[model samples]
Target: MTSQEIFAQIKKKASFLCVGLDPDPQRIPKHLLKEKDPVLTFNKIIIDHTIDHAVAYKPNLAFYEAMGPAGLETLAKTLEYLPEEVFTIADAKRGDIGNTSRLYAKAFFEQMNFDAITVAPYMGEDSVGPFLAFDGKWVILLALTSNQGSQDFQLIENKEGKPLYASVLEKSKTWGTTENMMYVVGATRGESIAEVRKLVPEHFLLVPGVGAQGGSLEEVAKYGMNNQCGLLVNSSRGILYASAEKDFGEAAKKEALALQTDMAQLLDSYCK
Candidate 1:
């Protein structure tokens, strides 16, 4: 979707929430497992339940890739089932040389038709530029992530004292405009968000590490929000895996609604 379309959805739904679909087969409800494709069954139900409460859906590709062909089939089916109006992300942190990157872009944008894809920027411009060639699709570059090991590289100070992640933001912004580019700023890095925002004030941020990861939602919104509500706060385990019981979908929807309600309040303040 285009930036205008994305912002419109955020306004219409009163939500910037992105529900992460990191489904674990073992954790799925036994009743769902009885179906031929339990993962898709779980995703379809969850999508139906939370569609109105969220503006985006991110399916972590690793989770499905591990399940092999059947898992991939489920992933494809899940994509087909999602509503066209909502943004869809393949949380596949793919980055390669120019040729391979082009194929990766085709895989998600043309074949899978995901609205966005998570991209690792370690290989520099060529690894990410191919994905930017597609119009109306997003490349969510990994910056300071929520993981503990992120400090090993992302936090390292350069000769001029800028953090490695800061440099990544500065250098990569030229590869794509706000319409096709976004950076992943972990919710756990609440204080650093102000710094990251300065680097690319208008670009959308796909923020994970909330919910189960214990990142504070209020802190992220307070420091990270822009006039357009330029934040897609994500919750995975804390929402989708809220319950492994038969009522899992209902429970997931309840958790998502709570986040959406909180997001509505934040958006009101920003959009004012």
Candidate 2:
């Protein structure tokens, strides 16, 4: 989906929430285990419950990949189940050589039909270019991520004293328009988000680390929001594992509603 379309959904739903469909079979309710495809059942319930509250659904590939061949079927079937208007993201975090990257893009954008895919920028423009070549699909490049390990490389400074992520935001911003590109800015680093805002004010940010990871939603909005409400704050574990019983779906809905309620107020206060 284009940036305008995504923002439109935010306005319609009164939310910029992106529900992360990173399901762990072990953590899902035991009643679901009796089903033939437990993981898929878990995902369906989560999507069904949160659909009204979320604008996007991101399924991290690692969880499905770990399940082997059946896992891929689970992933494909899950995609088929999502509503077309609800944006989908493959949290693959893939980037390689030119040809390899092209294939990765085709797999997620063509075969899987995802609206966006997370990409690592360590391979430079050539690795990322192939993805952007596809019409309407998005490349969510990794920038100032929320992990503690992010300090290892993203914080390193060059001769100009600019951090590596600053360089990523500056240079990568030139490769794609705001409609087709977004940066993955972590919600934990609120001050860092202000720094990112200075670099690319118009681009959307696919922010993680909000609920389960302890990132402040208010802090993210205070510094990261723009005129378009350029943020897709994600909540995975908190919503997905809200309950270990049959009430899981209802619990997930409650958690998502609470976040969306908070987001509605943020949009009112910040989206000028």
Candidate 3:
């Protein structure tokens, strides 16, 4: 989907919520384990229940990759099942040499047909450029992440006195326009989001680390939002594992609805 289309969906749904479909078989309700393909079944239920409240669905590739061949098959099926109008992100975080990166882009954009794919910029533009070559597909580069380890490299200042992530945001703009490029600014780094916004005011941000990660939705919206309501705040465990019973889907829907309602109000307050 193009950036315009994604923003349109957010307006239509009154939401910019992106549900993370990171299902851990062990954490899912035990009742679902009895199914032939429990992970797939669990994902379908979550999607069905939360689709109305989310504009995007992100399936972290690790969850499916860990399941081996069957896991990959399940991911393929899940992608096919997702509603076409809703954006899809393959949080694969793949980055390598130029040739390898090209193949990775084709894998997700052509083979899998994901609307976007999370990419690592550690290898510079060569690693991320191939993904941007695909028209209408997005490259969500890792910027200031929420994890504890992000302090190790992302925050390190170079001789120019700029943090590594700041350079990533600055240099990457030349590689792709706001229409096809986005940055992953974690929700826990809420206070710094304004700084990020100043660097790339028109680009979108795919923010994780809310809910189960204890990031504040209000703080993120306050600092990160732009005229387009440029944020896709994700909630994974908090919504996915809301319950461990047969009513888990209903519980997930409730969590999503709560987030979507907050997002709707934020959109009205900020975008209007």
Note the clash tally of each candidate.
Answer: 0, 0, 0
Instruction: Give me the runs in candidate 2 sitting further than 4 Å from their true place.
Output: none
Please, what is the TM-score per model?
0.98, 0.99, 0.98
- Residues 55-99, candidate 3: write the lDDT tens digits: 999999999999998998999999999989999999999999999
Return the TM-score for candidate 1, rounded to 2 decimals: 0.98
1-272 in candidate 2: lDDT tens per residue?
78889999999999999999999988999998989999999999999999999999999999999999999999999999999999899999999999999999999999999999999999999999999998899999999988899999999999999999999999999999998999899988789999999999999999999987879999999999999999999999999999999999999999999999999999999999
For model 2, what is the alpha-carbon lDDT of residue 224? 94
Residue-level lDDT tens digits of model 1 in 195-266: 998899999999999978779888888889998878999999988888889999899999999999998998
CA lDDT of each candidate? 0.92, 0.95, 0.92
lDDT for model 3, please: 0.92
User: Candidates ranked by lDDT, best first?
Assistant: 2, 3, 1
lDDT for predicted candidate 2 compared with the true structure: 0.95
TM-score of 3: 0.98
Q: Which is the leading candidate under lDDT?
A: 2
Q: How far in Å is the alpha carbon of 126 misplaced in model 1?
A: 0.6
